[model samples]
Target: MRAFLKKEWLEWSRTGRFLVLLLVFTVFGIMNPALAKLTPWLVEIMSESLTDMGLVASEVTVDAMDSWVQFYKNIPMALIIFVLVCSGSFTGEYEKGTFIPVVTKGLSRRKILAAKALLLYGMWTVMYGLCFGITYGYNEYFWDNSIAGHLFAAAACTWLFGVWVIGLLICFSAFAKSSSQVLLGTGGVAMGVYLLGMFPKLASFLPAKLMEGLALLQQVCEVEDYIASAVTSGLLVFLCMCMAVVCFDRKQL
Candidate 1:
């Protein structure tokens, strides 16, 4: 496992993808706070412009919690984008026939899959830690008593959502013949779940709740009204990981 993880890291680091992801995540972290600070001014400008068109303007106040909310919401989008970008893990190699040599060298298929998963997880863990550290530092510098209670637990749930996405991506990779196909498959499922979660009755049980209900965890929202949504998200992550392993184990590659 250690050797495989090392090989995975070396490949990613050499390709410069790791650096790019870190830079992007750092930018997202910094921008979250900056956007939070500018939101009120933005609202005021919008109000003035709309007032000229006979639209009434309502008072709006921006706060630290709003910053955290934006951070949580925006980070997931970044994570999903990363997921789509890196969907080529196994499929790309199969298409290019790059894995044939490695596989022939006696590397087990299961190890290969596990290595890639570990690689993706490692990249995500570093990016998330950096993003969180930056957000916490700036948040402390800019606002008093801004950190919400249960923030870590909330963050854990959000991270679990990303893990679930990764697991699905792995499963998709195993089942599909190409990266584009994998992406389409995973995307279709995500879209279906997202649409289903729109109904109030289904919202409590949908995996999409993790990505959609982040604001409540950040103290920028009152979604505590739906405790079931949070529980469902956690359950989804656990199940998805199991599913990924099962699917990969059955794959012919």
Candidate 2:
């Protein structure tokens, strides 16, 4: 298991996917604070045009909350990139028939699936943490971060949402013969959940509610409100992993 994990790490590193993810997350982290800081100046530049159009551009007030809002807004895009990059996790091996030799050599299919799951979850956690840390540090330096209510809880909800997506990816990868199919399955499930969440009565119980971290930060929704969604997300992740393992066990290389 350890050797396979090491090999996975080497594969990501050699292919530059790890570095690419790191750089993308870092850029997003910096952009959150940077955009907030530049907002006032940007408004000032537009002020004259607004005055000529019989409108007034009031003073733009920038704060830590603004940066944090940007953080939540940009994170979904980052996660989408992550999903696209990792969509090939199992399909590549499937195409090359690499798992046949490994399975014949005594590596259990369960261990192989477990290793991939571990790496995927680990990478998402690290990248998400790096992005959050960068934004938090810059926000603290420029403004009071305490103004954001339930900040950590909000971030955790968003992180959990990312983990849920990873679970979907892993499950789809186990059954897919190509990267496109994996992405289609993963995205289709997410979209179905999102549409289900549109119904007011069903919204709170769905995993899609985990993405509503901004409501937590704004204090429009209490931390307790997230309990249902968080629990559901966790259960879904477990279910996805179990299903992935079962499917992989029966899959032909």
Candidate 3:
């Protein structure tokens, strides 16, 4: 397992995907604070044009909360990019016939699936942490971070949402013959959950509600309000992984 994990790391690094993900996430992190800081200036630049059109542009106040809001907003986009990049985790191996050699050499299919899942989860965690850390540091340096309510809890909710998506990606990858199939299956499930979340009665029980971290930051919703969604997401992630392992084990390499 360790050797296979090492091989996966080497491939990720050598393929430039790892560095590209890192760079993209870093830019997102910086953009959160940078955009918040530049908001007033941007509004000022547009104020004259608005005045010419008989529309008044009011003064805009910026703060740590603005940056935090941007953080939550950018995180979903970051996760989307992450899912698109890693959707091929299993299908790529299938196409290259790489798994056959390992399975023939006595590597258990469960271990292979486990290793890939671990790497994907680990990468998501690291990238998410890096982005959060950068945003938090800049927010603290520029303004009072204490102004944001339930900051850490809000961030955790967003991170859990990403984990659920990763689980979906892995589960789909186990049975998909191509990357497009994996993306379609994963995205379809996510979209279904999102649609279900639109129903008031079902919203709390759906994993898609985990993306509402901004509500916590704004103090519009209590942390307790997310408990049901968090629990559902956790269960779905576990189920997805178990399904992935079972499917991969029985699949033809």
Go through the candidates in order and give each one's C-alpha lDDT. 0.74, 0.95, 0.93
lDDT of 2 by residue, 47-103 (tens): 999999999998989999999989989999999999999999899999988889889
> Model 3, range 69-95, lDDT digits (tens) per residue?
898888889998999999887899998
lDDT of 1 by residue, 44-105 (tens): 88997899999987877766677787787688778877786688877877777766676779
Looking at model 3, the pairs that clash are none
Candidate number of the best lDDT: 2
Error of 1 at 209 (Å): 1.8
TM-score of 2: 0.98
TM-score of each: 0.81, 0.98, 0.98
Clashes of 2: 0
- Looking at model 2, residue 94 earns an lDDT score of 93
Clashing pairs in 1: none
Ranking, lDDT, top scorer first: 2, 3, 1
Q: Please report, as a residue range, the 10-residue window in candidate 1 with the lowest summed lDDT.
A: 212-221
- Where's the lowest-lDDT run of ten residues in candidate 2? 94-103
